[model samples]
Target: MRSLIRQGADVNAGDVGGFTPLHDAAREGHTEIVKLLLDAGADPNAVATEAGDQTPLLDAIGSGSIETVKVLLARGADVRGNDDAGWLPIHEAASRGTPEMVVALLEAGADVNARDAGNETPLHHAVARGTSQAGSVQIVRLLLDAGAELNAVDYQNRTPLHAAVATIDPSAELMRLLLQAGANPEAVDRHGHTVQDLARMNDNKMAPAMLTRALATARRDTGRSR
Candidate 1:
């Protein structure tokens, strides 16, 4: 690769799809190659046209390449850079449930509540893409601890709790966690669907009951606080 650069190869040359050498290296998790490309003067923040205008940092996070992410960050990549889809590296990290990556991005100044084009935060992606209820619960706890807004609404006006209840197999524990983190069970979506409405629509038997109990508890807590 160094030989090619010395031979007058354009380090920033893009394919027909606009993916530069850095995008390839970063997407494939080639940490060393990424360094070489950066040293060759590859644009660290170059957006790939075929890949939804995603920066190399977004690609590295999508591929779960933490080492490559570090390399990009060290070379002055944009930590807050988003793809054409409006996904930040932190959103990808949270969606993948990689706590270490989440911590790394957070330390590098990734916004915990940075909304995507759809107005969804990393917490929203974390819950929506969670492979298991337990894993989703853990990610939620991590984001909440990092000051994620429990009541952040998406484009549809759905909170994380709304997303949780709409899951194929909604966990009462997940719902409880959001409520405890100050999510409003009474919040409605664009179609005028509340968390309980989503629970019923998704046929999540446990969620409606749980949401009801949570709402009652929240009301009681408010009353007591007053």
Candidate 2:
């Protein structure tokens, strides 16, 4: 490592997969080694062309180490680096359902509302999680707080609310959270389905009650303004 750097090892040299030393270290969560390579003139933004232009920062994220992710950001790893799927690191973090990882990327100015190849935002990814992870709800809240477009539709014209409603065993907490954030209950998807429509279609027994309550609240609020 240090000896090789001192001996003029090619820090940025890529293997057949275009993976540099920085990519390897970051992927393995070897935080110190990442720093050492970066200091030795490793290109933090070097792309693994054979691997969908995957950067070291992307690997750091896949490694699931906030420390390694932070080190990459500190060394000038571009948060906006494009991968094969048109996903930013934020998209990956959001789907992985780690609130802290999303927070780190958000703090580094990752686009909370940025669309991926599927035209889905980080919010879409968070809500589309079929099975809830530990911080899934918090991830949704974080994106909302960061100004994620709650109603932003994807290629399927499905908003985050739409996606949440269609999830198998959708969380009541998530349903309430989105409605509280002012998500439109009547918003339609590509198939012209509303939240209730999707709920019924999916046999989601939970979302209907919450959606009804939200609609009633919206009516009450509307009446007051009148």
Candidate 3:
């Protein structure tokens, strides 16, 4: 990269949508190329001229490249830089359920409470989409340990509990984890349906029963609080 930079290649130049070579290299996991570029004086936090919204840190987190993330952060990359969608690096890490990436971002000062444009926090993404449930659950536990807000709601007014229940018959472990993490089982969506209601609507008996149990626990907890 230094040789190329010495040859007058614009290290900071990005393609359309602001993707520079550094971004591509980071996404592609080219650690050597990334090191070369950084050593050659590439702007660690360079926002693409066309993509001027994200820093290399964002790309690193999105790609779950802990080495790249460390390199960028060591070179003074801004961990909290927002992309076009207002997603911070932590959000990217959480979405992918990359606990290593999440830890790196947190160590580098990524905001634990940062929300996207949709008002969805990292916890919301962790419990969504069924395929990532295990990873998401692990990520959620980490975030909760780090003090992520449990009662956060999304644009659709769905909480993390709502997302978990939307999955078809989620495991008892997952249900228990979310509840233990403080997910509100009674959280209502924009349509005014509780997670229990949605579970019943889908004929997912196990999920509704789980959510209902959570609700019962919460009610008892609330009564004690009063």
Please name the candidate that would achieve the greatest lDDT relative to the true structure.
2
Q: So what's the TM-score on candidate 1?
A: 0.85
Candidate 1 lDDT at 16 equals 81
Query: Which is the winner by TM-score between candidate 2 and candidate 3?
Result: 2
Worst 10 residues of 1 by lDDT: 129-138
| lDDT, candidate 3, 1-226, per-residue tens | 5677878998777677877788888876677788888877777777765664877777776666678878888888887777778887788788763777788778878778888989988777666644433366567778888888877888888887777777664544555667765677667889999876777775556776766676666656667877
TM-score to native of every candidate shown: 0.85, 0.86, 0.82
The sequence of per-residue lDDT tens digits that candidate 2 reaches over residues 63-86 is 878899998898898989979999
lDDT by residue (tens digit), candidate 1, 1-226: 9899999899999998889999989989899999999988999999887768878888887677778888899898887888887888888888863676788788889899998999999988887763472356667788899999988899998888888778776666666667766787788899999877887777656767766776676666767877
Query: Model 2 reaches what TM-score against the true structure?
Result: 0.86
Clashes of 2: 0
True-vs-predicted CA distance for residue 63, candidate 1, Å: 1.1
Model 2 poorest ten-residue lDDT run: 210-219
lDDT of 2: 0.85
For each candidate in the order shown, give its overall lDDT on alpha carbons.
0.81, 0.85, 0.74
Q: How large an RMSD does model 1 have? A: 3.1
Q: How would you order the candidates by lDDT, starting with the best?
A: 2, 1, 3
